[model samples]
Target: MTPSQIAAFCLQLPGAREDLKWGSNRVFSVAGNKMFAILDFLDEGRGGLAFKVDSDLFLGYVDRPGISPAPYLARAHWIALQRPYPMGAEELRAALTRSHQLVVARLPKRLRLGLLLDPA
Candidate 1:
């Protein structure tokens, strides 16, 4: 799918929000106050998109056309996936769910509880 299409897909998750951070070039989406995906191609070759992915499963995506280890965050458990992949929409949705889950897993217990209990 296209970049905008991918970005829109990422934002479809419940309570997802986007912002132009990292110099206002990339668009990042967060869930439960945790970032799950970021748009790195909005500018050009200077930036790359990153998603919260498990290190073990990360290797599977590394060699994909536009996929790679996210810059500094890669070592901290992040992967950059280039848009327009041959991957199907179902696979993309699963990846997004995985990314969102990874971030949720890292949140503090109290914060996690709050997110679960708070309904607005």
Candidate 2:
């Protein structure tokens, strides 16, 4: 997805918010301070996208062309895509949604309830 599209989709998630961090990166977070995705504008050439993936699926994702373990976050199972083209747009959206769900699942019970997220 394009940067604008990504920003829009992320902001639409329950209780999601965006902050500009490190000057050129857009950080999308839920429950206030926990980040789920990042769009890096200053990345060399055409920018990049990074988000957390299920720990069990992390290696599989990074092995794909155009994707790699996200710098500094790989131990937590985050992955970076040089661009979002390796996957179809719908697939990318689903991944983003899963990333949001994963982050939400770890949030405090009160915070999750405040966001009106189901306990699934």
TM-score of 2: 0.93
Residue by residue across 7-56, what tens digits does model 2's lDDT show? 89999999999998887889999877999998883494365888999999
Highest lDDT model number:
2
**Overall lDDT per candidate, in order of appearance:** 0.66, 0.87
For residue 27, give model 2's deviation from the true position in Å.
0.1
- Measure candidate 2: CA RMSD: 1.6
Model 1 worst lDDT run, 10 consecutive residues: 24-33
RMSD, one per candidate, in order: 3.8, 1.6
